[model samples]
Target: MGILHTLSLLFITTPLLLLLLEENVSNVEARDHHHFGKKQKIKNSPKLSPAYSPAPAPSPRYPPSIPSDPSYGPTPTDYNSTRNCIFDVTDFGAIGDGATDDTAAFRSAWKAACQVENGVVFAPSDLVFMITSTIFSGPCQPGLVLQVDGVLMPPDGPDCWPKSDSNKQWLVFYRLDDMTLTGTGTIEGNGQKWWDLPCKPHRGPNGSTLPGPCDSPALIRFFMSSNLVVSGLRIQNSPQFHMKFDGCQGVLIDKLSISSPKLSPNTDGIHIENTKSVGIYNSVIGNGDDCISIGTGCSDVDIEAVTCGPSHGISIGSLGVQHSHACVSNITVRNAFIRDSDNGLRIKTWQGGTGSVTGISFENIQMENVRNCVIIDQYYCLTKACRNETSAVYLSDVTYRNIKGTYDVRSPPIHFACSDTVACTNITMSEVELLPYEGVLVDDPFCWNAYGLQETLTIPPIDCLQDGMPLSLAENSSYAC
Candidate 1:
């Protein structure tokens, strides 16, 4: 009718303008698929981010009775059947030039790589063997291994080596058996040029005012060894006694890392004289003296998981003269952690000396800021003019179970001074706790007829001796207190 009604409104506005041009091309292809998925998520963001992760972390839950204690056992043998020989002190031509005396090419490469049978004398990987006195004579046949991977340097500058009375132990492992001293080595005892060598005005076996001839020479001297094993070493700056194990047997000093520099004189870190079944586990002795010094014929000794600080704790004797022997007996120092040490647990005896210190035990120790945390010096070499001697030795069955923390109220956490003539018998302090710095609560005494004023000394009143009372002495003598 009007040209078919204007072509029926041009086919109904040409199907509504092709449905609004396909809805604006689907909103411009969903805005170009949301900018191409944000440029492919910023080009795959560094492969899902995490630059350097070689993977390793998450292994620390210790306390399965803290590793079954026989001094944290198990490691008798089979360290890969052991046999690692490598020795290279600059290819046996070691010329650190310090006057060139490489000690017979390091004792003929340590007796030809410790003469076979389970050998291990590997000391290569970057050499430095300027030695002076190196004697490792031994019967090290049963699984022999002395792997000190480079560095036994000593004689550098100090008047071209002057200190002499002929005793400069850089490393002398005498009378050995199952030996071992692993890699990442170093035994540098240049010892401040032997502690500035000038104190030889001697004449004292008791001459009253003249002492000075141990100037320096004892970095490592283990005489009479047995199934010995010293692992992962680092013995440094020792002018004297950094590690001395005289008369040893079945010893095992593991992961040792000793340091010396707190007025470093007579640096006694590991001194176990007259040893028997000894074991110093996971060490780090910071020395001046006795980080571990159990002198006078030690027996079944065991110091577990150690870490004594600033040194001088765990001593069992200044004991006796004429060495009447028998100072340390079946001992056990467990789960140790002494800090700022100076006698966390000591039993020093030497007012005269006779010997019979019985079964000692200090368990679960964890001292901090220590300074004589618990001490017993019958009269340990009493310095500065004070001598009322008398100790024909006898500190019996001593035990300080589960000692815990903090000390130093001018040093008197517990001081037992017995032996005016033997009277420190069967002492025991269970679950001992002293946190003094002026918080005083001191009542734990056991002195006993101290000097024997004809024996009438009795003590049994610390809450009726903590519930299980029974301490009677001569005039009767019972037990359990």
Candidate 2:
């Protein structure tokens, strides 16, 4: 009876144990499958979602709206594309020995590179390339860069220049848009011979004068171009203007060191004419003539962070010469230092001009021993031959703010000799304290037909300023240019 009971118990227990073992195996397989799925996900899937990924950065404006605040520099889009499409001037039969005429080689390289988009015309570094008067004319492909790393030397003197080459300009970039000229290089204009011309101030060894033809060449000229950039260049000893921009729009010039001898004649550092929306930033200009000169048909120009010395200072030209009409407006020069300069801030216009100059601002300027700290001479004649005329370029809405300086005792700190018939209106000033550099005797500020309010009492008080516009300009709409 006992044996029979044992067999029965064993039968029941064996079936239950088999059932439990099957369930355990199935559970283990399911757990293993779940772990494998997680591993696959970890191995195959990307970490970040498309929604979380950041977007690419934006490109900079060629000529930024607030160009006085320049926050960007030139950068190539694709290095490989630029390298592959390089048109090397040396490869175009250029001899970088400083004596060979590299003009033809440069022309060839430019012609070839100008056709390719995102092209680079490279001037090899650590060499001196001599070129005669040459013009690099182009309506180049979208992104063109003239990367000049070598020293570019022009002809030794005026005697070396060919007669066919116009004495007005040497190296010219004409009709180019969306182009950049940049690199760590030097443009040496051997201008001693031109400066010694009879028409110039320095005539002969003994300071004697001689009669001769005198037409000096500008070092670089950008003519009839739009969307241009000139950066990181050192231009020295230009015969005339170092760099001139004529009929250009959306132009930017930055980080330039332009210089010439203190006695160099008519060597204006950077001159702009008929150009709009122009920007000049972070430059050092020390030349004989105006560091930065603005001619007629100029508007929306912004100049900042400039160091000008041994110069005639920055000027708004002898505009409206020969009884021509001149219209200039919206010019701002800010955060500049003028030291040992002939004039600090000046606006000189011709006597018999028709149009007007308005909406000008000079702010945060520091002058040290400047001869004429601030001046506006309507009768701006180089010689005594300029006869006075009734109609003149009307000057209005000119603001000089926070201009502090030391001036030479010879001349008054501020001189505003406006037009007699068309008096200057809204000529405002604030915090202008100009002390005499030599003595305590400070010259009084001079004013003629100038109207404005002083925000604060200046060091040498400006009691000469008269209130109210001239009757001719009050009734005329021409004053509102």
Candidate 3:
């Protein structure tokens, strides 16, 4: 370490070690003082000592924390201080003024941090660091940490974005294992200009199609990783999806406050695809697209106690697009609230795609002023003129228990537009109550080729739901996984 760095470590370590060892050190000192001989030696020791008492200037044995700046960071973890290898970004020439580019400093700090066991890269509180698109690649030692107690933001817009970097994602964590990114801070995307792009659906004249590529960046993503935890983060205003996890497993996301303008196009709060063993709990999200969207190849996902509003609600698949083989199963969304959203609980798939969506449950969900409270659209399409196709993904074993909500009168409360050939089967709804928000019922809750029995009488009754297996049930079993 350099002179400045040595001093920095010493300064930070003093308080942290004192915080950790104060009680033990006090007890030891009291035990020593209890002996009369040690007290007499201590009383005589000052005679042998110099005028300026050198009491071993606060032992730097433990790991260092953030410097004693006005913006001291929070305690990142409760682990033993001996296990932490701390690296502060400010030590590597980071100027956290929110305007200056801190990409190099952050990169350099991460390089050092990733080399050590139980590595911790600390972004201190009361600072805003703006960086460009960068991937923090890792095969680091287990228990790597990114303790962000401050703000992390991107450049102003696309014009300021680097041409060499990818436009699809920003701040990607690739090939990481056993990583925990927790913070009482903000990861603001500053995505106002990206939302105003000419290629955006709402941007062009008369909402017309602008002939251009409309690719904007998702704020943060974890790709090809596992055993990851992200919590206590206030992530907002993404150019596209706020947080996406792809090809990862053992993921847990909690206590996040994710938001964007309702009009911002394609700004899903959290999208997880090709991942499994995930738990998203106690998070609140309001954005343009689905609050949480589950994509293909995902299973064993439990989402609970999440609140969504002014956004499309939790969804499973806009999957199997372009004749792809998609598989999703064992997804549970329970104890959630949705309000002022487009589609509350949706499972949408495109035509001409073959796969299987099964073992899904939506329990104890409440909604207000939402359009299409519970839906399964097998023929999902953006364009008005989508030709009907016979081949489709088979959806089965879906249960909706204790779902009560109010829906916009424009769309039906419960709509199931299943494909004719591969109809949805074994669908059961128990204690579902969907009421019209405008106090006047639309009198049409449609269900097509959906085979399920209602456990209790539903409001505006689902009399359209069929009871037994369809004749095509034997043929629909071809698509499995």
Candidate 4:
């Protein structure tokens, strides 16, 4: 009787145990599915730089973070889609013989691709296209990519350039937005002849300027554009500035190998005017003029990890030229290395201009045998014949920190040739040690009518800087501009 009872109990409990086990397995499967779905979502999310953060309004005392990686741009998509359409220059009758005038083919190709929603105007590899001074104007489709895998050479000399084309610019990209220009190709401006002209510096034994057609064209110019990216190209031997941006916004220049002869006159690596929200990163620029030149009406510009040498290191303006109202603000250049350059960092403005330059910073700079390691030449004049003017561009709130390097003994380690009436105000320098390159006699930091404070004692002490801004310029509205 006992054995029969035990058997009955076991049979009844067996079904209940099996039901619990099945429920447990279902719960485990559901949890695993939910976790996998989360993981997939994370994988599909857009990858962005964790380091980059833009500065707030007014001025930031610290360096603004930026995207660390250089690989941020458009990618491939479906070929059938209009936005993903690719138009090769060869399809438009380009010969790529290094002598044929492929300007027409390039223009035609650009027109066809520009109409597409997200088109690509491709210059295929293993080709050398000799294009003329052409203007590629566009109100093109969004996300257009100018993928250049071939060499694009300008006319061999100034004589070959068309008479109708403006000598001030070449390869103009006007009114284009959301465009990326990238490839392992070169844009070579055979500029030796242009530099040899009488008007250029190569003419005279004493490097004196002569009278002639002096306006040499920039290799590439972007006018009135937004959201532009130029990367992975070697732009070399420009007649004037290698790349010029005017009235543009949201420009990203990265990984460019821009080079010109050290004696190449007026061949500025990159020049910006009336542009804002610019980022120049991971580039090497060696030229005669400023590696990066900031002109009038520029603000919110950031430069990082650039190596500039055998050139003017970087400049903020020969602004307020010809008595124009020039206003530049919120400029920062950091993590840069300069070697054998003319000026490590410079802010130059002409006298007799009505405007201001404020909220500028240069940090983490390493200079090698640079001249004028830190300079603010408010009375900047190319020639010494510039007459002093009472009304000048107001310069204030400039900071120079972590600038350790060697400076040439020809000039003072620091030069602040401010205007008499409008003295530079609130100029701060900290952690700066600029020793003479080879001589034991270190030049004193020159401060001509400048005012500011040093956070600590610099290598060559700057005792000439006054404590604060002048009372007259404090309430002045010119600085507000």
Off by over 4 Å in 3: 1-84, 206-209, 475-478
Q: Per-residue lDDT of 352-409 in model 3, one digit per residue for the tens? A: 9989999999988887889888888887875656777888999999999888867786
Give the clashing pairs for model 3.
none
Local accuracy of candidate 2 as per-residue lDDT tens digits, 331-389: 99887888898888988887788788899999888878898788888887656656768
Candidate 4, position 195, lDDT = 85
The TM-score, computed over Cα atoms with residue i paired to residue i, of candidate 3 is: 0.83
Q: Which candidate is the best by lDDT?
A: 3
Per-prediction count of colliding residue pairs? 1, 0, 0, 4
TM for candidate 1 is: 0.31
Clashing pairs in 1: 320-353
- The count of backbone overlaps in candidate 4 is 4
Tell me the whole-model lDDT of each prediction, alpha carbons only: 0.57, 0.76, 0.77, 0.76
**lDDT (C-alpha) at residue 258 in model 2:** 96
What is the Cα-based lDDT of residue 202 in candidate 1? Answer: 23
- TM-score (C-alpha, index-matched) for candidate 2: 0.84
Q: What lDDT score goes with residue 228 in model 3?
A: 83
